[model samples]
Target: MAAPARPYRIGTGAGFSSDRLGPALDLVRDGRLDCLVLECLGERTVAFAHRDKRADPAKGYNAHLEKRLKQLLPLCRAKGTRIITNMGAANPRAAALKTVEIARALGLTGLKVACIEGDDVSAIVPMSTPLYDEPGTLADVGLQLVGMNAYLGADAVLPALEAGADVVIGGRLADPSMFLAPLMHHFGWRADDAALAGAGTLVGHLMECGMQVTGGYFADPGVKEVDRLADCGFPIAEVAADGTAVITKLEAAGGCVTPATVKEQLLYEVHDPARYLTPDVTADFSRVRVEEIARDRVRVSQASGRERPASLKVTVGFDDGWHGEAGVSYAGPGAQGRGELAARIIEERIRKAHAVAADLRVDVIGASSLFATAGLKAQAAQDVRVHAAMRSRNREDIETLLWEVESLLCCGPAGGGGYRGAITPCVMTKSVLVPREKVRPTLEVMIA
Candidate 1:
């Protein structure tokens, strides 16, 4: 006889803050969910991680994630709810150790914790390469590789579960893997199960950003009384055996889970509705349907998926060159005219100084037809505010532009008093894009 289906109820907790763990723990303690997913990374988070790694490699892992996890791990163990998260941005091994230490501190022994590695691509970014092949340009233009993390797939999580891991952590795994891991663990779904994979992909997309899927990003006109902006709830999926799930959230949580919210989240960050790519599978978003089942619940079903490719594309950045931007804002009456005059005066000052301000372009905002190429409509208004910005290849040129800008405030326009504040200098950084073929994934099994 086969084991009965272990239908799982999944929910995502608030991100990066230890304060959120209390409420999250309450849900788990109440037996509301079997797994907790957390998302705490973005472009800005990666940038911060880069800075921290430069300052101290030991501090590179997101500290906030550890703090919150520490508070929730004990509760998860008590409630039998496993944890999976993407807190391991630049350092997975270190993060795993920290989680183990937290579990040990809580007196939980034989707790297996796994770290999924091989996502970093900091060293091998090619000098001239785009993120996608020809006809699909959005290459890593000047985006310096502070760090590279591949979105690992669901297959990686099964090993941790097989090893009896109470909690599995990874760095830069696909957003959907957090949800897919539980399904793979329970249903024993193969990687090629298109329908099951599609269900997992849909679940991941719905809860990847936690609150955003529930109602935080919901823009429906029917939900007038619901306070979307305050105390918004994160999404939770009660997945059944037949590759179907009902999306809901914590009771009394402040967000609505209407079809509109689910629809908007389905469309978030998606380029094509037909084929949504992920490391585990290529999900067909068009086949999925969202139905408003109740006041705060929605049913997602009929999702289909395609097979995943063998090799995963990893995003790596390298040092290419340097670039910087500086700007000054002008406000009040006749601001447009004064801004134009100030730009001319600043350019003249740089020319007079014989400074090598290469590409020292100046512009007056709030002026009619100034940015026609950018498709910005020119509108007439009194007391308009103008913003002038300049970009350069080196810090020296930016410094020269800064000095020239100061001179204009003194002699360019009568109302140049808005420029009296101190000028800040910015560093120029460049990024190089590299392919996944250039980097390899390193897998290791460890006991917690």
Candidate 2:
């Protein structure tokens, strides 16, 4: 493949699983995007989908796959825009079949949907796969492991794109790799083109979250003010042959795209600006230039890259038993003291029971629910909500703790009201690295 003289335009559709479908339609209709990537998988989301797969072999893909395809496929096909997504979750073949169903229903023929798989390398991962942020390994993760998938890079999708697939459905690839695959395919970048891959990865990271680069989550009135936030737009990247891009949105869209918004998104979830690791390459955003070239147009250039990691990070999910939480509100004068006392009484009861005190967390919503720290400013308001959350390996422990919190309404606090309580099953995750050679990433295409 040869690099094109003209630039390529790529737009983001859905950022997360529940992203607005309307904004994606807006991009396909007007953004003039050569490709649109709809990212729908997160770390824990795929884990949950894995659990579904365990129950039934064919039920592991993204829940909104059919609806999203029904809404976007016909439009994308008509516009000659290649669509890519990680909605394959635990099952790419299943997702592709659903895409086929959608295409046939819409009377669209010869639509080629590619399903990229081989990211799930649980067989290669050792039983004692060590956790990145914890002391123990998967051995300590005593629950039933639903999924164990590697974060694949964009390299596998190249074959499908080269074979002229219109849509590529991937499972458990890195978030940025969704956009990186299209960029690499369009630019004909070599696997060894670390600089090019790095720049593309940077562009992918900036656009992966969809509207964050378009002012979706960067809003703070009177501080980081954003206009028309109710209908915020998604991001579009105008990529040059060199992999540098201008992050912008659809014309006359609700959200504004500027350098500030791009900067915020660039650093989101990035631990180190010098070495941002991804499946493709290690990106260096430290020396990148951010300039507002035009209204709602931010130019990000000079993103450097290093060699890809020798190993891929695999996220493993296990059943963590149950989580129980309940909250009760206290209003009027002396609400602060009452809320604190209620939280304390709930904690003491759980401690007196068999549940671990360290596994429990109590917060005063009107005081410091966020950050969950002791020194944060406690707002002096007439209303306060006391909340308690507990995790236990057994469901009974959480149920017992939640019962104590619910009891606060009738027996503990003077003005406690609005009692809410619930119990939920939680799937916990641990990160491990598997050798790149172990993951056999492949792309399979389905034609209609």
Query: What's each prediction's TM-score?
Result: 0.78, 0.95
For residues 251-284, write the lDDT of model 2, one tens digit per residue.
7688889888988988999998989999889889
Candidate 1 is scored at a TM of 0.78
Error of 1 at 301 (Å): 0.8
> Which candidate ranks first by lDDT, i.e. highest?
2
Give lDDT tens digits, candidate 1, residues 1-448. 9985665798887544232555466567664678888766654455556556667876667677667877787788777888887787677777888888877887878777878777765555444544545333224355444555566777767777777777777777777877887887787787678778988888888878777766675545664445644676666788887778888877767777888778888878988877887777878889788888788889988887887755566544333333433445566666676666666777776667665646655655556436746866444334443344555445566666666666665556775554422333333233233444554555555554
Candidate 1: lDDT of 237?
A: 89
Q: Against the correct fold, how does model 2 do in TM-score?
A: 0.95
Residue 174 lDDT (model 1): 71
Q: Which candidate is the best by TM-score?
A: 2
lDDT of 1 at 204: 86
Candidate 2 Cα outliers beyond 4 Å, as residue runs: 1-4, 133-135, 353-358, 377-379
